[model samples]
Target: MFIIPAVDIKNGKCVQLVQGIPGTEQVVIENPEIVAKDWENKGASILHVINLDGAFGNKSKNLEVVEKILDTVSIPVQLGGGIRTVQDAMDLLDIGVEKVILGTMAVENPETVEELSNKYGSNRILVALDSKDSKVVIKGWMEKTEKNASELGVSLQKKGAGGILFTNVDVEGMMSGFDMDPLLELLNAVDIPVIYSGGVTSLMDIENLSKTKTFGVVIGSALYKGKIDFIDALKYQKIL
Candidate 1:
């Protein structure tokens, strides 16, 4: 399994939210370009980025920040949030994002997902399914939908999504380790690669997940707040 460090951008700054709550955010650093470069230098193979503002309603508010990171890091970066159209995906890819994650658009406009998959291929398209209590949330986890993560995962595969980024919102940023049940269910339910995110707190968490078939792990607050160290995490996963 690959260890992917997360860089969530809000207001053009590196920040992390507890349990996906907006008010619970804290700025980790002012310059994410430096942070992304540091993570790459520390041995990260892939960088996962999220636009919190875009997830909420502001679109591409942090594309500049993403651009800066791309300029600084040699590793590939996968981005998600407010990517609602084919043009949006195209623009991000053209701008150097290795992959574009479709979250809200996957649920609300699967046709766009198909178009993007056809245009960019599945390898460049990832569907992010953020869930709580089995129900998928959209518009930045602010709105809960009737669609469950498993069901969404299946639909995205049919629509040609390259991979699934399964995040358990209840455990997100809680540092309690990923909610494995949902991850397992989605992994079993989908044929595509599933990248697990949320609640990764220790080397044990990484070890436990390493035993699974997860394509990668995106760890944020735990690593940022010193609950987990990046180098130790890479070592635990044998990536170091």
Candidate 2:
């Protein structure tokens, strides 16, 4: 499985949010391109970039920063946040994003998922199912929906999504380890690649995740805080 490092951009700086919260964001790196290149140099095959501003409803602020990161790294980058419209997805891809991750858009307008997948090929589209207590959350994880995550994974797969980025919000950024029950449910529910996010604490977490059928895992706080070494974790996952 791929060990993807997360580069969450907020206010034009690389930061990580606690449980995806706004005020709790801590800037880990002053320059996103530097962090992106460092990860690529350290053996990251893909980088997961998130626009915290866009996610919170200010979509236009981070495009320039994202552009610099893309220009700085040769490795593939999958971006999420504020990608609510087909135009938004296309604009990112047009600039160089390897894949566009849709969250609220998937829940609010699944037809756009189908349209983008058809136009860009399924490989270029990913649907993020961010959930709390197994029910899907959207609009920056502030609103909860009745839809179950596993069910949403299946639905997105049927709609031609290339993969699912399943994040369990309850343990996210806690450095406590992953919640495997809900993750496994989503894994079983979909045939497409499922990349897990949220609480990842140590190499043991990656080891446990590797035993499953997940496509990959996105590590943010753990990696930034040095609880887990990126290269060591990659070696354990046998990705490097």
Give the number of the best model, judged by lDDT: 2
Instruction: Let me know the TM-score candidate 1 reaches against the reference structure.
Output: 0.95
RMSD of each: 1.7, 1.2
TM-score each candidate: 0.95, 0.98
- Please identify model 1 stretches exceeding 4 Å from their true place: 236-240
Model 1 scores what on Cα lDDT? 0.87
- Residue-level lDDT of model 1, residues 158-236, one tens digit each, is 9999999989898888867666788898889999998889888888988888888888999999888898888888875
Q: How close to the true structure is residue 121 of candidate 1, measured as C-alpha lDDT?
A: 87
How high is the CA lDDT of each candidate model?
0.87, 0.91
Residue pair clashes in candidate 1: none
Worst 10 residues of 2 by lDDT: 231-240
